[model samples]
Target: MKTINNSSKALLATMLTVLAMAFSTTTQADGHAKPGDFTRGANVWRDNCGRCHNIRDARELRDDQWYSTAFHMRMRGGLTGQETRDVIAFLTSSNKPARKPIITDAKAPTASSKASKLSGKAVYNQTCIACHGADGKGTLPGAPDFSSAKGPLSQTDDILVKHVTDGFQSPGSPMAMPAKGGNTALTDADIRAVVKYLRSFSK
Candidate 1:
């Protein structure tokens, strides 16, 4: 059995990208399509996509465009139908433009005041787990280790939530985490939940 080298993998990824672009310019909706889990898709993406090349920024494509591209990738990457759907979910969800909170309600929870209906662990699994890993030690290079006493998790909740909301690049990380971990749908409360959850990693 012969193993393909990194250069071979890189070449393959490039070819796949070219093929994807050639595959379609129009969005085709599938009525029977099953929605993929964003978090699972993130895990699939992190664990697999980088094997071929540097991961493309999710913001580079429209959600509809991602559907076609993800399908193309599915064929080339030998991803399962479910995995393909998951990747599509991850791509489409991760790419949306960030929306700032419009607080018209006088009773809205302030950023400084913490409240969340979603559990911190739930938020972490959904948004933060892809890069941060389940252990909080990080799955990507330069991702902060949550278990470290002096790491990002040790920061105050206010700082952590702000960072999650605004996005941040670690000193040596090859890539920066997108705001709200690329889930613009996440609320201030969700960020706070994940932040609080992540803190437990250090303790």
Candidate 2:
């Protein structure tokens, strides 16, 4: 009984040590997030992080702590690249002291600029690749295959865009695509870019 107890305690200590090391490594690896990804991160937090716990207020952690915690959670949650950056952005941005925005009267971009600025492939990779797949052949069981002639891409651009923006449950499919592909930060142009990317597979 004494030997058994010692073994159990040793195992527990080893596990704890490994965990601490992992956390430390993750914190260091995450570093600081760049700006502009905060809105995307907010959406990621709501969609993914909310699954396990009440969405903690981002202000709950200081900047350094947020980086560590977000990085740790990212490893556990399987977030990568921009998704991780975005979450960190959301947390760190929220940690800032709140203040009213300085308003400036500026005209919106012209149509040509908006069209050129967004990349369909980048948007698709960031938002849709999780479910829809890197090959346009969905990871989810019922995710529509963009490469298929009779798939979602077969629909008119208007119909596809509407379905994507508003979210869609295929007629007989088990999984439902989330609204704005779960990234509410995505602009209308972003959605169109994703659609264009998907359509590329058909060509």
TM-score to true structure, per model: 0.73, 0.53
Q: How high is the lDDT of residue 159 in model 1?
A: 85
Off by over 4 Å in 1: 1-32, 102-114
Candidate 2, residues 1-203: lDDT per residue as tens digits?
43558889999999999898777753343334344375577567757875776556554678789777877887888887567778876666555542222542244443423553669988886777756767988655566788886877888888988887777777766545656665556666787777877889888
Task: State each model's CA lDDT, in order.
Answer: 0.80, 0.69
lDDT of 1 by residue, 1-203 (tens): 99999999999999999889766744333663567888889888898888897777777789889989988888888887788888888788777655555773356756434566678898888788888888999887778999987877667889888888877778877677777888766878888778878878888
Q: Which of the numbered candidates is closest to the native, going by highest lDDT?
A: 1
Candidate 1, overall lDDT?
A: 0.80
User: After superposition, which runs of candidate 2 have C-alpha atoms over 4 Å from their true positions?
Assistant: 1-116
